[model samples]
Target: MALKATVLKARLNISDMDRGYYQEHAFSLAQHPSETPNRIMVRLLAFMLNASETLTFSKGLSDEGEPELAERDLTGDITLWVAFGQPDEKWLRKASAQAKAVRLYTYGGRTVPLWLAQNKAALARLPELEIWEFSEEDLDALTGWFERSMTFQCSITEGVLYLNNDDESLTITPIRIKDRS
Candidate 1:
């Protein structure tokens, strides 16, 4: 009998700034590049909206009832609020440990402790995730993946894993390893 397979396709579109500005630039849970807050937020949102379990992004308005810094250029720092799928407070602490130019904070709405994020105890989690810095080599590898699209598949027995892409699509399939020769 053929192995039962679950196919999933994911699409990724990187920001134009990233394509024009940095080295095969791709953001990850572990780090971000030094750039403007708005651009950074765009980058984060591009990834989070698709990958994060829960998240939000917004800006405060000025006392004049205008959007905060409406008169000013959109080049200033802006705070970002993110909440991964965990019920703890440590993730915020960890993300804030380093002195990044932009502010990254947890939502008062709900918090996910870092231990749960770190310990892999959460039922919904990101594991076996990798952030690939776009490079000629990486592009070559992805080209290979595309050329062999018909044979590709991915599965998760326990956690929520996302395979990010700079410019590509994918099909994920869940199957028993033993069924493969």
Candidate 2:
């Protein structure tokens, strides 16, 4: 007879696991062996900016064999459960509520009332809007940068990321989900 087992793990601790995935990837991209502090910061920032988003999540049925990830409803805005690893339904419901609560402040508003933000499905459809007040010089620079870099296909320059101030350093690096399927 044959048997199967399931595997579970906690989410990587962001503060402690600095060298785990993102840093390793960035180091591999380097031509030399010495790991620069700036490279670590650059890759981390890039990873965060790219990965933040609203994800619809669903779980597989127990009788279906191994659990699986599936899409939830995207038609309506709702709160969603996002886990660092495979999650149980109770945890999902709790996490969905928490995530929605946190995002309310991100929209530049007062704290969302518990009653108003309780619907998980309704909160999921909220668009992630990032507003930046750009000056005329900043606007022109952004356009020029996008035209020369993002619009056309070009390899990114090495060691180009740098820190401008101490205040800009405290930022949350968004979670990146690796494709297993």
Question: TM-score, each model?
Answer: 0.19, 0.19
- Model 2 residue runs over 4 Å out of place are 1-50, 53-131, 148-181
Task: Evaluate all candidate structures by whole-model CA lDDT and list the values in order.
Answer: 0.26, 0.25
Give the local distance difference test score of model 1.
Answer: 0.26
Ten contiguous residues with the weakest lDDT in model 1: 172-181
For 61-119, candidate 1 gives per-residue lDDT tens digits of: 11232211111224542222222222233433333332121122111112223332464
User: Could you give candidate 2's per-residue lDDT for residues 8-95 as a string of tens digits?
Assistant: 1112112122322231111122211242333223222332222223322233223232112212335643432222222233444444
The CA lDDT at 72 in model 2 is: 30
Best by lDDT: 1
